[model samples]
Target: MAKEVYQNRIELLQGTLDLLILETLRWGAQHGYGISHAIRARSGEVLQVETGSLYPALHRLERQKWIASQWRLTEQNQRAKFYELTTAGKEQLVRDRSKWEAMVQAIAGVLGPVPEPEA
Candidate 1:
């Protein structure tokens, strides 16, 4: 029952995961687990990225040359692949951020501020 509820949970928009992953890497290189944790933490735990989406997105970004990955030892002395944003990724981040800002503004305009409670 619990698993079913989790499986039915809403996820990030179709392509927003790419932008979020790129944004997280802006800080520096991070392994897959670290990236997911960072996204959840930064979003105040509101967003939980499923591995099913994360690995594929990471691979897609790597193929697009937006991010590069290499194997390294973690603080735990374990081997892991760390991904870092490339120059192109940085540029894409700026573009994505601009689009996101515009999107938020448009949505806000539609929703409008809550009118003060009818006196």
Candidate 2:
């Protein structure tokens, strides 16, 4: 059904919001809403990040010094906090990506051919 297909379109982000946010900021500084839109747009509208998750991750990244933020006015003149990746964030992103690739490979290995039962 169309509803089932729509449900399938959304997937659990599974602790990757940090990586996603970091990756998103790589392009340039953006406000919170802008970051969310960018991620959804990039993911073909499948990865819809909720505000409850997004803001906390942003703050956590800020505390960890992986990202930096500043209050800025949008084109519409609304005040919002814009986040950008730091030097440390860039390095961390590289590490995260390596880890992600390793995880995918490991899962793929587990999903590969099963051994035949001994007689």
Candidate 3:
């Protein structure tokens, strides 16, 4: 049962890593591992982003100029490529969040009759 829940969450997170990554960086710059760990932590361990997917997505986002990366030394004095959102990325994040929110609403509607929130 726990395995099933984890698997389902992984499936859901696959489609949202880009958005989640962007959102995580909104707090500040992070290296690849930090970013993935942050996502997992923020998602309450529901999302464990695999390196197989994460590195490619980071490269892709860097290519798109949605994010920029630079080498920096961590507190441990180890060099790492830290990624931070660009102005374009911030703009794109806003648009993407709106679209994501709309998608959630549409999916919820399809799922049917969620109880309305009290005002």
Candidate 4:
């Protein structure tokens, strides 16, 4: 028997990742690992945010002042930097959410409703 190899071809575009990161921060402050874990969990493991990709995104959002970071001790008593959304970030989230909803609705309209299955 041959084993099947799975691949993920979707690469999040330049700013999309920042948007997702910001949305995650909307819940509250979280460290790098916490953010990645929450996203994966919330996505039901369908989306995996790699550390290499996540760290850079966090730094970029921080640079843009969309998110703020501070050092804090984790439950394990280890020091780590946690991030939270700024007021500007909350506004951005509202805008992004609207944009995403519109895009999804547009795509759904193109696809049309699914046909009913036979009883």
Q: For every model shown, what is its TM-score relative to the native structure?
A: 0.83, 0.81, 0.82, 0.81
Candidate 3: which stretches are off by over 4 Å? 1-15, 114-119
**Candidate 1 C-alpha lDDT tens digits along 13-96:** 645888899999999999999999999999999999999989999998999899999999999999999999999999988988
Clashes of each: 0, 0, 0, 0
- Please list all clashing residue pairs in model 3, or write none if there are none: none
Residue 52 accuracy (lDDT) in model 2: 94
Q: Which order, best to worst by TM-score?
A: 1, 3, 4, 2
Evaluate model 1: give its TM-score: 0.83
User: Distance from true position, residue 6, model 1, in Å?
Assistant: 22
Instruction: Note the Cα lDDT for every prediction shown.
Output: 0.90, 0.90, 0.90, 0.85
Candidate 3 lDDT by residue in tens digits, 1-119: 99999997886664477798899999999999999999999889998999999998899889889999999999899999999999998988898899789989999888997788999
Tell me the spans in candidate 1 whose CA falls farther than 4 Å from its real position.
1-12, 113-119
Off by over 4 Å in 4: 1-12, 113-119
Error of 4 at 15 (Å): 3.4
Model 2 lDDT vs. the true structure? 0.90
Candidate that would win on TM-score: 1
TM match of model 4 to true structure: 0.81
